[model samples]
Structure formats: C-alpha cells, structure tokens
Target: MSTPTTVALPTDMELVLKVFPMPKDSNNNGDIFGGWVMAQVDLAGAVLPARYTCGRMATVAVNEFIFKQPVQVGDLLSFYSKVTKIGRTSVQVLVEVFAERRVLGNQYVKVTEATLTYVAIDENGRPRPLPITELQPRRQY
Candidate 1:
C-alpha cells in the first residue's frame, strides 16, 4: 500500500470548526458535494471576520475557491481561518479545509481552500461601515 499524504496544520490560523461528513453529504461519486463544502467554507470563513464585523455580516463574494482533493464520508474535517483584509465595511478571509483519514492514522489532506468577502450590515440590511473601535488593542506582556 502507498503511504498516505499528510500536511502540517497552520499555526497562524485559528481552528474555526471541525466536523465529520455523513453519508448524506456525499454525492454519486462517493465524495462529498462541492456545494456542501462551499457552505462549510462560508461558515468557517466568517469566524475571524465576525470579530471585526460585530453585529451582522453577509457574504458578498467568493473571490477564489479550489478543491484540492475529494472529501469522503467519515473523514474528520478541520477548518482553519484567518483574516486577510479588514476594509471600511467589509472583511476578507482565507479558509483552508483539511481532512484526516480515520483509517489512515489520521493523516491530514488539504481538501479545499477559499477566499471570501463579507460586508457588515445594519438592521435594515444596508451595508454599514465596520466599527473601528471594536478592534481593541491586545495587551502587551
């Protein structure tokens, strides 16, 4: 048998989510659907942006998305995310999804990577400038 591929998880990014795909998430080819992956990416990608967006935000664009490998049922998926840009009223995030095989000694395989943009919104659903004061300074040791 060939050795399974493994990738080092990112230290700079945050572990936003971890999930296991069910059989229902798979397609005819026995791999999970791309839409399902995109939906998860959207959810995972919003994590870092939420800190800056505060009240509410909406996905405005998927700047880039690439599915590196097929995700099978029962694979443990970990979603890592980081903020790439924080604009006046929007935040761009990079989300990378890695899958671990339960039978393959939990070797990690990068399944997907996506860049998404989210715009802060008001109660009326209109775009609103991000609250700059919300980004408080971190304490220095």
Candidate 2:
C-alpha cells in the first residue's frame, strides 16, 4: 500500500474542525470514501450559513471541487471554510481540506478544495432572503 500524503492549509485558513478518518469509512480500495470527505465539506461550508441565515438552509450547488490527494484511514483531516459571497438568498463558501498522515507527523498536505453555494431556507424549504448584517460588506453584484 502507498503511504498517505500530509496536508497543510494556508495560515489564513479558518478551520471549522479537525476530524480523524476511520477505517469503517474506507472504500473497498482501503482509501477513505469520497462521499465521506464530501459530507465533511458540506458540514464545514454550512457553518456560516446557519449563523448568517439564523435558520434553515440547503446546499444549492457545488460550484467546484478538486481532490488533490487521496485520503486514507488514520489521516487527521482539518476542514477550513470561508465566505466568498452572499446574495439575497444564496451564500457561497470556499472550503479546503488538509490531511496529516498518521505515520508522518508534522507534515501536512492539502487534499481537497471546493466552492459550495447554499440558499437560506424557511422551515418549508423555500428560499428566503438572508438577514442583513452590518459586518457584511455591500456588494454591487
């Protein structure tokens, strides 16, 4: 088996959480499943939406996703998220994943990165305008 890669995200990165991949989450090939990573990314991106919308929300689009390295069991995964844009009912978040190989301590490598768009929603799942915030900058677009 090939050794897992280590990942180090940017210093400016805002991490939501650090998680360890488990063996049960692996695919038949013994690598961590892609869907597992995707779920973590979704959760990471949703953190801001919950606070900004102050209510329900749903993922509308995965604008972009690129996996740079394979994730394996025992890798310590860190999810970092940042807001890139916000509209009337939609919020765009950029998420990056960094993984530290268990065997190779002190080394970190970026494993995946993505842009996700989520829409603020009502309890009924209908889109709703996000609550305006003084901290949020006004955008012409």
C-alpha-based local distance difference test score of model 2: 0.83
Q: Residue 63 lDDT in model 2?
A: 98
Model 1 Cα lDDT, one tens digit per residue, 1-141: 133468999997788999999999999999999999999999999877887888899999999999888899999999998888888999998999999987778789888999999999999999999986254343243
Instruction: Tell me how many clashing residue pairs each candidate has.
Output: 0, 6
TM-score of each: 0.90, 0.86
Best by TM-score: 1
Q: What is the C-alpha lDDT of each candidate?
A: 0.88, 0.83
Which stretches in model 2 have alpha-carbon errors above 4 Å? 1-8, 133-141
lDDT of 1 at 65: 98
50-135: candidate 2 lDDT, tens digit per residue: 66887888999999998888888888888888888878898888999988875676578788899999998898999999895334
**lDDT for residue 130 in candidate 2, whole number 0-100:** 89
